[model samples]
Target: MGFKFDWFMKGMLGAVLLAFLWPEPGAKGGFLQPELLNKLGVALVFFLNGLALSLASMKDGALRWRVHLLVQCSTFLLFPLLGVALLWGSAGWMAAPLQIGFFYLCALPSTVSSSVALTIAARGNVAAAVFNATLSSLIGVLLTPLWMAWVLHQSGGNFAVGPVIVDLLLWVVLPLVLGQFSRPLLKDWASRHKGLLQKVDRITILLLVYTSFADTVKEGVWSRYNPLLLLQTVAGCALLFLLVLALTQWGARLLGMPRGDRIASVFCGSKKTLASGVPMAHLIFGANPAIGLILLPIMIYHPLQLLAGGMLAQRWSSAEAAPS
Candidate 1:
């Protein structure tokens, strides 16, 4: 337990340090060019996603359908609505760019690798985790843009959903679909090379984070958002995380879900996917590179969520082992 906590904390600290230390010469060029390093990181992330998914053991009969339904509601319908409401309420006060960032974060999908890892650590239903993660990614491609359009429209921004959808289909959905289709040929190889792939996943995420933060720094986004606003964003994200975590857990219990399914629902439903969000942000809001600053909430919250969720899972697993 101590080892796991130590490792997680160290990895997070490393990521944060890397974000600050990574050079930002590209940002000075006045264009958000896709550096070869960043593109390679994105591709590696997708490849590992495909590999991790292939190793997942999903049993159709194992899950409680009602629990899955509850998860979907929390992830797809409930969270997006909350995000729209928050943005609408703050529209009069928030800067236009930050408003877009808030909306974009809300529309993003749930995390995949971390979700399953936490679920497995907690002794939850891994298969359900995979299913929910994959399904959320698929649905998010469409839902994110739609929800963003609605939010932006309400906020009086001129956002065209059609172009967003086209971009999503081209960049996010198609890569995922191709990865899924290639799973048969890659799964065995991935299994054999799990260690190497794991390293690749870690490196890719680190590069993505560095590039993203570099963009924010380059765009003068940090200066635009003061300390107070940064704190507010963090508070808002914490509230959002707590709300979803509680709601998902309560819904799971209310539906009489088993322990494993409940764990899966809570972890999978409560989190957002950075892997998907970073790429989608580049595709959808590339015109404004500063839009990546909006993802800060998720980026900040992701590690916190994982640390908290992991500890909770560890506790639950220990309790389950105690004899009656």
Candidate 2:
């Protein structure tokens, strides 16, 4: 989550930059274009994930049901509720797609790696962090699409829940299930090639970003958005993050969670996963001209959460180290 670039993130930025500058590669083309690659990449990414997951570790973490419930509720339920309220109030200021996009950001799952990493840095419950983070992603595989379908349907859009669910099961869920079932045969090999598989996850997300942005660019998405809307998106996301962080902290204390559990709750519950968000956007918003606008809040929220979480983790860690 630091400012330093991982080669994967760099590739992500490069893909977006390339798409922005010259979108012809990712632009609408025949069957062999970037769009088709995105579909295959999505399947491949989830399948590899199925191989790489440690079911035993996930099971071990599952025993902490209360903590897990809190984190997932905060991630899936509370965030979206708050986002709805904000989007409702901001409709005048924010455009239609962007307003809903902000709400979409709230419904994303917690980051798998960074949530645990930040929890460890803050002296939080790392095992619970891992458990909740993993569980959040798995849940999001279904929940995110359902949430999007509901939200869009409520807004009277053409997004059909049946189709959305079918697509998710086919592209995301099926591959994951296949990978899980195939784990016995491939687990050892997956562990050996873990680093390489993670790169696949990064690449899948990048390709989705490239193609989505390229489509939006062709539709003149950037032309509609201005400097003020961009700034507003940042401010709104920061405020939303603060609100979630504060509420989770209060909720933890009310539930009599320990300091470690409280720390995990705050970090895991308050943060959203960009890695998952970008790809899911493609699945949900498929070929929408305003896809770029829908991603604005999410793109802004990613870095904001990192910087905010980094500072908060350092301060909390320092406080924990001090004698009371």
Candidate 3:
């Protein structure tokens, strides 16, 4: 089979280019009213997420404590510690906004969709993947903010936690709860239109990316940085993915986990959600043009994980099919 390029990824890159060439529509105070759309997109994504969640599957996956613990720790702890170490080591060398982006990338939750999709392709414990990915996103609402607050403080920037938390609860948590409650009435319909719902999620993310880069470009945020710096940041994002992936694999092996559980842990633990990251950045940074700059690391990291995870899943799938 021929390799297929990810359409959503291509769309994202195009969105960035569009922002560069013609950012007028998406920028703040522009004709599109992207700010209003962004807010709606955030709420819509979470509501769809809540509506799609499977309570029974979640219960079943919850029994695997070891797998869950490893995924959560690698996501929230191992990655963040690595970010801090990198920041400390690169103190004199790297740019500040990019530094914050890198750390924020580290603290993000496991991606809900891609993580589960890759796990299933790899013949992993699907239930556990679903549970862990969902759990990570929920917990990230709280943890990501806390981590960003510290990063902002360290960089001498301000973070009003009270307002940010209120916004998150209002836009993120509240919509999610409503969606989950609506599931009793909407689950069958949601399940039937899964493909459409997934598209909605992807489109919202693309919209967020477009508006953010538009704001950044309009404010001349990229003028201060060079293309070479971006190349380096891409390298940094790739390295971070590799390091966490290796750690998760090693931890799974040391615990003598079954192959299925190990695949679940490795994939789920290594992913950082660009979907959640972008919306949260908007809430946290407001209209600061640097919000786009702060999103660079995860934007770079997302595709890297998808490419690598796809290859790994194919290999694992073939291995599982082989005769002993």
Which candidate tops TM-score?
3
lDDT for each residue of candidate 3 in 55-81, tens digit (9 for 90 to 100): 777786898888998999999999999
RMSD of each: 3.3, 2.0, 1.6
Whole-model lDDT, candidate 3? 0.89
TM-score of each: 0.84, 0.93, 0.96
What does candidate 2's lDDT look like per residue over 1-324, in tens digits? Answer: 344446765776787788789877776782338667867877887787677666677665666666887899999999999987986788677888788788889888888877888898899888888889988989998888778778787777887777767778888898989999999998888889888778777877877788877887877877876668878888898899999989999988888888888888888998898877876777788768788778878887877777888888888999999998
Name every residue pair that clashes in candidate 3. none
Model 2's alpha-carbon lDDT is 0.81
Write candidate 1's Cα lDDT for 1-324 as tens digits: 212444434664565565456536434342435455555555556645654664345555235587569767887888887777777687666666765666576677788777888888888887888888777776787888777777767767677788777756655555666777888888788779988877766656655555666666666776775667767777777888888888898989999988988988898888887667766665566556565566667666766677778777889888888898
Question: After best superposition, candidate 1 residue 183: deviation in angstroms?
Answer: 2.7
For lDDT, candidate 1 versus 3, the one ahead is 3
Model 1 residue 13 distance off true place after TM-score fit, in angstroms: 6.6
For candidate 1, the per-residue lDDT at 180 reads 76
User: How much does candidate 3 score in TM-score?
Assistant: 0.96
Candidate 2 lDDT at 235 equals: 86
Counting clashing residue pairs in each candidate, in order, gives: 2, 0, 0
